[model samples]
Target: MSEQSSQGDDDPGEPLRLSVIVPVWQEAATIQATLQHLASIREAGHQVIVVDGGSDDGTPQLAEPRCDRVLSSGGRGRACQMNAGAEVATGNVLLFLHADTRLPGSTLAALKRFHTSRNAWGRFNVRLSGKRPLFRVIEWFMNRRSWLTGIATGDQALFVRRPVFEALRGFREIPLMEDVELSARLRLVSRPFCVTDPVVTDSRRWEQQGAWRTIFLMWRLRWRYWRGESPESLANAYRSDVRNAQEP
Candidate 1:
């Protein structure tokens, strides 16, 4: 995984073809809608791949007809599933999308701009799907922080050139913070192309756990991660916190 490789020098004059990779696990209720929302991208000749993490909820069945390909990851974990999707991706650029996130109409145009730029990777600004003023503030901070730090989260709809992604060997197979870890590595290779067009991500987690509490928990987890805590431990704590929040 040599970051110095000249793979990013691929001909910029060539048209950019995007491959949207969505990793899912037991998302039967929302998978169809997510795939349907990408209809325009597919119609534009871009490829869509759904990698299911052994979803027994028939997510694969529903996604198969809507996308270009549906692959079974044979296990869970977004890092692994997304890596699997990237393995079969045929486009020059790969965009990792969340099952609950919706890209704006200007997504393709933004991607085209990124392809012509010097950047090898990028992410879209994110907007949470909640009407509350607090959600607006949260999204503003998220977008701003990412712009300043060059680190992106999965919810932001991360995209990268296929060669750059392969050079980095995809994401680390960690229990948590995989996106953060990958962003840190990518920043060393090249500054991220921050697109202003926002991707609307579902605010279900914040709404379910109480926005304030979720904010506090996430900040605490990130602080610990920056302090060199193990991802496995952080993942356990996150799961415990979420379970407690769900308790009646």
Candidate 2:
């Protein structure tokens, strides 16, 4: 479906129209439930575009029925696929969501309340979708860190006014740390809204890799990246770690 056909006229009192763009790779494990949760926002008149990065796992097939449009991104990177989705988006605002994440039920209404201001970008706080006691502490730190730094992870559902996004030229095409790079640029223009309401992200990665180990690795990667290490090196190291985790 096209954006124009899906959109309604601007009601001065109504929320700004939103286009939620999700970039999916081999995410069949979680895509369906994520789409089902997003369906409410689409029903409320927002556009949901899912960009598939050549997922051999039939992600696009599953997403096509639930989304406004599911496009084959013909690429393998999240930044590339998300930029492709943003290209065809026709709403006043854009939201980049991860397929493993679920937004708050009241998110659209909350976005409506916040987007009316001069503030151009923001993100939701995030909760990891697992029952482990440590997940709560992780969630608190994630929210607090973002509050202090104005940087957002993809799991947080980063959103921005279309114009601001265009000005920044979207996420840089990189193998990793694209969210961090974009957040650094965005903060120069405006302070992020840092909505306290949280989006829930799948914690399977942490569970698979062991929570403490994953946390330590992530901090090490961030520290290196901030110290100007190349993303290619970081991505290679990350892939190696995940591969090792899956080996035995």
Clashing pairs in 1: none
Candidate 2: TM-score?
0.93
Give a tens-digit lDDT track for model 1, residues 1-248.
01111234545477999999999999999999999899999999999999999989899999999999999988899999999999999999999999999999888977877787778798888999999999999999998899889899999999999999999999999989999999999999888887777899999999999999999999999999999999999999999999999999
Residues 1-248, candidate 2: write the lDDT tens digits: 00001123434664588999999988787788888999888888889999999989988898889999998878889999999999999888999998888888879877776566656788888999999999999999988888888898888999988999999999999999999999999989888876677888989999999999899889999999999999999999999988888896
TM-score of model 1 (CA atoms): 0.95
Which pairs of residues clash in candidate 2, taking residues 3 or more apart in a chain or in different chains?
none
Q: What are the Cα lDDT values of the candidates?
A: 0.92, 0.87
* Model 1 error, position 25 (Å): 0.7
**What shift in Å separates residue 15 of candidate 2 from its native position after superposition?**
4.6
Q: Point out the worst 10-residue segment of candidate 1 by lDDT.
A: 1-10
**Backbone clash pairs in model 2 (N, Cα, C under 3 Å; residues 3+ apart or in different chains), count:** 0
The window of 10 residues in a row where model 2 has the poorest summed lDDT is 1-10
What clash count does candidate 1 reach?
0
